[model samples]
Target: MHRTVFNHGIKLLKPTQRCIPVAVLPTRQSLLLYISNHSLQNRNVSIKTELSGTNVAQPKDANNVAHKQEAPWDIDFTNIVEAYKSKSNYEIFRAAMVFQLCTIGFLVEHGMTISKYMKKVTGKWLFKKSMNMSFYGHFVAGENQDEIRGVVDKLSAHGVGAILDYAVEEDLSEEKAEKLEMDSCKSNVTPEYETMDRYQPHREFSDRRKKVVSARTYFYEGEAKCDDNMNIFLKCIDAVGATTDGGFAAVKLTALGRPQFLLQFSEVLSKGQKLFERFCGKEGNLVDRKFDQLRFETKAAKLGILMSRDESQKWFTWMDRDDSGYVDLLDWNEMIAKHRKFSDLFVVLNPETGDEESLLPKFTDEEEAQMKRMLIRVDALAQRALEKNVRLMIDAEQTYFQPAISRIVMEMMRKFNRKKTVIMNTYQCYLKSAEDNLCTDLALSQREGFHFGLKLVRGAYMEHERERAKQLSYDDPIQPSYEDTNRNYNKLLKIMLEHIKQGGKADVMFASHNEDSVKYALSTIHDLELTPQMQHQVYFGQLLGMCDHITFPLGQAGHRVFKYVPFGPVDEVLPYLHRRAQENRSVLSGSSLERSMLWRELRRRLFKGQIFYKPT
Candidate 1:
């Protein structure tokens, strides 16, 4: 009754057995192997290897057994979720938490009183402590490595690993943060979470997790004392283990607000608030010349402001270093995004829908000066990231701050991305201009001979951006509708992959919680016949706890998957946490599959009478 298994780990199938895929199985697939006509005594067996991520079949060379790539769905998530299900009421607690998140997200997204109410209530200690154990604990890794390690191990068991999201802030330390945030109004940056002490993990525990996990890093710029803040976050990693973990690291340009006075700057800059006007020396002098020209042409149309490029591609071309035959949309949009950021470009737009647009005159001398200073700091961050052999990602801020962020990221990429893509730029596809902007970036990469590392997300500031546009009576900068945004996301992904396929160098991270987007990415790679090496250039990302169903299976199938693993004190990371809640309401609602999937998983586990763990 013994069945024969080949030396290459291919199992011999019974003559009457039909092949079934692991994806369709609610449980682990028991290797549906079928043997072909080959001499058994000759010790060579031929088996067709056409399995997909789930159960679908694809054609491949039958003999190349040593180098097989499993489809993303080959990993069974029932056991994965069940293991985490063993962790303290993980399922039911999260279900309730997600409901709360959806409610909050709906209110915030819709511009209701709940957003304001939530913010006010977050200031209370009881509310703060309660959320830390529930929502925060679910999403963020521990404030320290011990807690982080536990969560990391749990995630790895399911094939999804972690990326630490560390935000720098206005205060120098936890002591200052406590006084500045908790004691006063709401903490501009809140909570003392990361235990920054030079602590070591137990050798025993270290050895155990070494097999299970690696970590990616996120640099969230705060302000002031950037060098110090950078040192703090960078040092937190157990460098030796991280190198072995096989994930990327990051550097955030906008988060490091004031290098010298970084926190002071970031404190004011949070939520897109502007600091006081500053003197801008030479840049200001040049802007004034443009201003005079603009005023002469437009007859004081902008009401005390002037813009030379109101009707010109001349300025656009001047910024297009690659001469891609089109303006550097990144720079062009940044100008528009920044103007909107500073004083609402929507305000200056004619409600008459005249189709003429205006931009803010250049920055004040001091503001321009700050950018120079910030670049200096950004260079240091990029250099350090290079030395650490880690990838740096510049977070995409609001349009107001994005130009500076984009400028910093481009410089970092040019300087460091010469050999490999150590620096990545995040592109928000929700904006109509993003695809053209990315194309400009692609041209920059080609011209400069650098691999463009890009992170694509649907976008975060839809509500704020739209509300302001409506308030200011300008056409919104976002895509006209959600369908448009999704279309842009899928199209940009296709464009990015095609760039890599055509031998244009690129690295991309598709960060989304949407199931269709995830499937589309995998299917595109499969259809394009992107080799395994090329596929590595593409990675899938989800916020930890938001899309485990997608990330876990993808990770298990040996696909590169990353989870945004946030680590910070309760109060400090609260704003980010709140935003995640809102994002899910929008992202997870389309098909109602998010809820159905969770309920199915929960009921299955409950029926199994699995061991239950309590939520913290």
Candidate 2:
């Protein structure tokens, strides 16, 4: 007897028609029913291409390929007892308590205010101990590399990998940070003074505040901090490589340089991209468009990117190497790169009138130097990752910083990702232009023959993006609705999957907590018969201590999954904890479901008299 499979739906057909059901696998909810209705014997898989409408059938040995591996269908996401087995009863109880607290509207909504109050009243010793015992212990891996190693081992034992993330992302600018050592040394409030007394207004304090001296400026302090951050990143890369081969380390560009500079750089890139769009006179693909020097210079000047006649002629001759009177996409990319390092085509000149003034903010010499320093740090990190056989994932930031962030990551991809998938960029699908950005980058990678790697996220900075857009009188970058965001995410996932199907050199980490999207991806992976090295090519990631139900089951089912393990001092990672709390609130139902599962598992363990208690 034979069954035929189709890409749409499963159906029972005459034995003579085909050897297996010729249809797409049903979703997670319906897959069990479909599997039960038909026997596993003689079941063949045929995947249909969406665009070409052609069937690509799997080999008869497809079912037997990973016969020793546990089938994904055997592991149920709701099997809380099994999922929480690695977690002790006490840990489960603590997680449940945390989730229960997150369910409270006021606590989650007013988290930052409450955190401030807690910081004031709790006292350093008592507060730090309490946090470490509860939320901090639950969310963060540990305070240092040694601690993170233990967490990594524990997770690895459960078949889950770790993506090490150093949690020091404070963006205090060098220009804004005061040199406290000089004047602070002269204050009446000594280092021995208690917290309350330190705030007291003494004569010395008043005198220090009254002094207005640029003579003791510390403009280079921020650069030093950037260097410090870079060292920490290097340490993190080492930790990741040492703990887990083929592991991941997350990088935030804001940590390497001043955040204000990133915002200004983003503004410049956005304006330049817009200028290119207008010059090309079309939206889709501007890579092959013929270039006109006069028109390009005129348009760039209007956008406040001035070019001298000599510079214009120089750029034209260099870009139009073929003498075809046209500079394509690669030429445009080179121009952007030159603008970053040398400001070749973009000359900052003083304008006599408002209309003729540069629309972009000019960077100080120090800021420009810091930009180079930041890029050097990024390259160093990439080199370390490549040497250690680890992948570097550049995290997505606020929309104002994304243009610059994306451009920088693309350059890194060009440098390091040509041979292996060492550098991965992140894309936040909640943005309105998520697909467009992904398509543009993917096209560039394809044209340039680099291994394109990315982490697809639903987005973290939507609230901030929208609020800033509204405050600044600009169009909102976020999608209009949550459903739209999901749609965008799934669309991007499908695009990547299709590229993989076509044998393109690409890797994607579906870093999401949405179960439906997870199921959708799993179903498609099976349907397409994409049996790549599961660990390196396709990945599923959830934050530490957030989604064990999804994480454990995916791991148990023989899929590559990792926990986004954040590590830093307790006080320094408060912002990360706050964001985690807010995200839990936003996905209240998911958290509630996990909590319910935890409770059920707790009940099971209690009734079974298998409870073991330990305090770490």
Candidate 3:
């Protein structure tokens, strides 16, 4: 029966599960044949059910189960000449050279250190020029909007959209923050930002841990620098809107405020959420099942909150939205999300005093003002994106910072995503709690009556996250192995795709460089029978100067695709460049498919006696 289905280019399934046609594209036949002829005949497939909308075939026989369901279609990445035909010979040559260097494990791993040493030996002037002609030229779009316009237009010409990123990030370590604090005290210098008139002076009620850890080193100077980043993002939004309809503007939340504040903020939420979870026992919806103000207060106070009846009543009254004297998950989420509204609700215990207090009350007047300023900047950027019809995608950072990032981005979505999915959050699938994160956010969006927007990526901060966990004596946040990450990525992909198939108000960008993941996404989309117009909400993305084989074919095949066009001054974007090189080293070094394809294309060009041939 499976063989018959394969012979015909029509859909056939077990009537219980909606399987896509077994037909393989001409380019994918070899791969399809290898899997089908060797694996599928023996196993009986069963669809696994879960709370989240994830459904995949599970074989009854445990052995070799993973091998039975390779996607039946693939994008032909081997057509290297066709993919490179759109690029100039010089561009291709430079990319080939850059990727060739990326193939060297030692160089990629130590690229930043080596570049710094080279700069010292070569002098800054010569170093800048050389970098501009090589790595910088290949990876980044340009330094400013006027320069970036050409890159956008070129990508648009090839049916690919552009995601403009102003590659400036701000992160300060604890040691650096302490140093700055000492330096400022020695100089007797006032902070760069002035205090707002409405806020009170630094108070004693804020959680003690925050005051001790983040008070002096919270990037007070960055108050002004954050404003600069906001302006750059505004310009990026304009550039995307002007150049292409429905383009994307990539914004990093860490770039907008102090990293320590975010870390502290995340810590507060993390603890609060765990307490909430415990308060909602077995079924997870205790607040909704029965409505009692005293019960709620008793539960909270027993769980370490020192709220009096009157104090807890303010929360109960506010959270009981329908005025029925009952709070549901949605109602609780609504109140918790407005962190500024209920200061007592967003609290952490004072480590020294062992008493609960809000993070806000402890803030110095300047710190409170700084928090407002950061929100204002984020609001302005989101407003500009909405006005410009640009999708604003917030990039995911480290786990310590991610909870706060997700929290704020969701707040933006509740506001701007009412009519359209203008604000999008990122999900890093490599995390241990990836599915839970996705399910929670998806549920919130549904309950709040807003569009859910997301971008999925296998995380980039693997080494940093692992090392930090080891040093801090905590459980590692990253998945144990590469295969685990891939499985999580695909599972999350299925959940979102199924949501779209069911006509849920959601949008997702399947941003990845992994070919198998990409093929699986495409296959799932086809199975769901989404038309090209419906696919406007779906997207694929790869970085500029990397994975042209995937990006170009995706564009040429008429799917909605985008290149992450990072732009900044050469010196400013070094960190981003280094990460780009280092993170992709596995794909570029030893037995890398991309390098082999580049080599194949280079060989073809050489044999044709057009090694340096410039495309007309």
What is the lDDT ranking, best to worst? Answer: 2, 3, 1
TM-score of each: 0.60, 0.71, 0.71
Candidate 3 deviant stretches above 4 angstroms: 1-73, 88-90, 109-133, 142-151, 168-220, 282-329, 339-367, 568-572, 587-591, 609-616
Q: What CA RMSD would you report for each candidate? A: 21.2, 18.5, 17.8
Clashes of each: 28, 15, 1
lDDT of 2 by residue, 1-616 (tens): 2232222221112211111111110000000000010111243432111111111111111122223443463347787766887788888988998888877779877775677678789888777887877778898876654555566556655556655455543423322343332222222322221112222222332222122110011122356766765665566555445433455566667566555455545665665665456655664445445557886666555554444676666656665645667665555555544443222233233333312123233344554555666677677777887887667777776676688788788878887887878777889999998887898789879978999989899886655556556655678889999999999988889888878877888888898888888988887776666654432367778878978998877766657677766666788677567667666764545888988899998998889887674322
Please provide, for model 3 over 218-282, each residue's C-alpha lDDT reduced to its tens digit, 9 standing for 90 to 100: 23344576676566566555544543334456666656765545544465456545545655544
Query: Which stretches in model 1 have alpha-carbon errors above 4 Å?
Result: 1-133, 167-228, 233-246, 258-365, 584-592, 611-616
1-616 in candidate 1: lDDT tens per residue?
2233323222222222221110100000111111111111122222111221111111112112212453543344344463244245464556545655565544545432343356577766665566655667676765554555566555544445455555312223334433332222222332222211111111222111111111111223334544554444344222311332223555444334332222222222221211111111123212121222232224323233233453324433433335654422343333332332322221233345533222232233444455455555555555555665556655564443444455456656777889887778889998866875577667767866988988898877666556555655555779988899999999999999888888778889898877778888888887787776677677778776665667766765657676766666665665555555554564445314555666666676678885463422
lDDT of 1: 0.48
Ranking by TM-score: 3, 2, 1
